[model samples]
Target: MSLKAQLQDEQKAAMRAKDKQRLGTLRMLMAAVKQREVDERIELDDEQVLAIIVKQVKQRKDAAEQFIAAERQDLADVELAEITVLEEFLPKPLSEEEISELISAAISQSGAAGMQDMGKVMGVLKPQVQGRADMGAISAAVRKQLA
Candidate 1:
């Protein structure tokens, strides 16, 4: 099934199961997806849906970090929980070893000799790593390799 259809099915199941937290998160996701469709006037494919989910997950993580920094454990926990919900639809994450290998290949493929070629390295790597690893971590790995 398409990710969007899977989400809608899960949303219905969550409602039937009275899973308030899951229901709320799914609703938020659906709203975001619907908003994007309406704004763009085009239906999103699975990849686009995955991209939206990844964006939501990032937002939750950032919010959780901000909450923690502000000493609001309860809010941080809530954000983290939402992140877990959002991540259910994401592809399994790449291991660090796998990411390192891929980064090395990208560097070699792009002939990125130093930090100056960071953009070239990333351009070669981003599509392969998107939604599977954090871009910040990828960039750091690229820097470490270049340095």
Candidate 2:
């Protein structure tokens, strides 16, 4: 089934189970997906949906960090729960070693001699590793490799 279909099924299950928190999160996700499709006039494949989920997960992680720093454990826990739900839809992530290897390959392929060529290296890496790794971390690794 497509992502849309799967989401609908899960939404129904959440509703039946009276899982208000889970249902609310899933509805928000579905709305985001629908908004993208409606605005862009393009259907989202699994990869596209995964990309959205990854973005949402990253935002939750960032929010959780802020909440923790502010001593708001309740809010932080909620964000973490949402992250767990979002991650369930993502493909298995790459290990740190695997990410470094891919970055090494991208650097070599792009002949990125230094930070000047960082954009070029990233251009190559984005499509290959999108939704598979923490891009901020990958970027740091790329910068380190070039420097």
Candidate 3:
């Protein structure tokens, strides 16, 4: 089954089991995806779904940091739970070594000698690495290699 169908089925199961946390997270995810589809007038592929999941996880992480700064463990716990729920849909992330190698290859392929060509390196690498590794980390690797 497609991811959407699987999420719907799992959402139903969560509801049946009275898994309130899972149910709420799944509903929030579905709403975000549906909103994107409606606003962009385009159907989402699996990659797009994964992108949404990554964005949600990043948001939760940011919220968790803020909660921590404010000494709100309870709120941070909720965001962390949401992150766990969102992560279930993402592919396993690439390791740092693997990410570094890919960035190095992209830099070489693009002939990026220095920081001036960071965008060129990223432009060459983005699609290949998308949904597999975090872009922020990849950019750092590229910059480190160039430096």
Candidate 4:
């Protein structure tokens, strides 16, 4: 099933099960997806939906970190719980070895010989790694390889 369909199914199930937290998170995600679609005037494919989910997860993580920094453990816990719910829709994370292999392939494919060609390498890598790996970590790995 498409990720969006899967999310809708899960949302229904959550409602039936009276899972308030999961239901709320799923509703929030659906709202975000709907907002983007309305803004762009195009139906988002699975990849686009995954991108939104990834962005949401990242936002929650950042918020959780800030909450922790402010010594607001309760708020941080809520953000962390939302992340857990959101991550259910994401693809399994790539392993370190898999990520290394992908980076090597991308660098070679792009002929990225130095830092100047970092964009080329990332351009090759982004589609393959999106939602499966952290882009920041992938960029750092690419830099280390090129350096």
Per candidate, the number of residue pairs that clash is: 0, 0, 0, 0
> What is candidate 3's TM-score against the reference?
0.91
Give each model a TM-score: 0.90, 0.89, 0.91, 0.98
lDDT at 113 for candidate 1?
85
Candidate 2 lDDT, 1-147, residue by residue in tens: 987789889999999999998998899999999999999999999888988998899899999999999999999999999998877777788999999899999999998899999999999999888888888899999999899
The candidates, ranked best first by lDDT, are 4, 1, 2, 3
**Highest TM-score, which number?**
4
In angstroms, the error of model 4 at 80 is 0.5
> Which residue pairs in candidate 1 collide?
none
Total clashes in model 3, counting residue pairs 3 or more apart in sequence or in different chains: 0
Order the candidate numbers by TM-score, best to worst: 4, 3, 1, 2
The candidate that achieves the highest lDDT relative to the unseen native structure: 4
Looking at model 4, the pairs that clash are none
Off by over 4 Å in 3: none
lDDT of 1 by residue, 1-147 (tens): 999999999999999999999999999999999999999999999889999999999999899999999999999999999999999999899999999999999999999889999999999998898799999999999999999
Error of 4 at 133 (Å): 1.1
lDDT by residue (1-147, candidate 4, tens digit) is 899999999999999999999999999999999999999999999999999999999999999999999999999999999999999889899999999999999988998889999999999999999999999999999999999
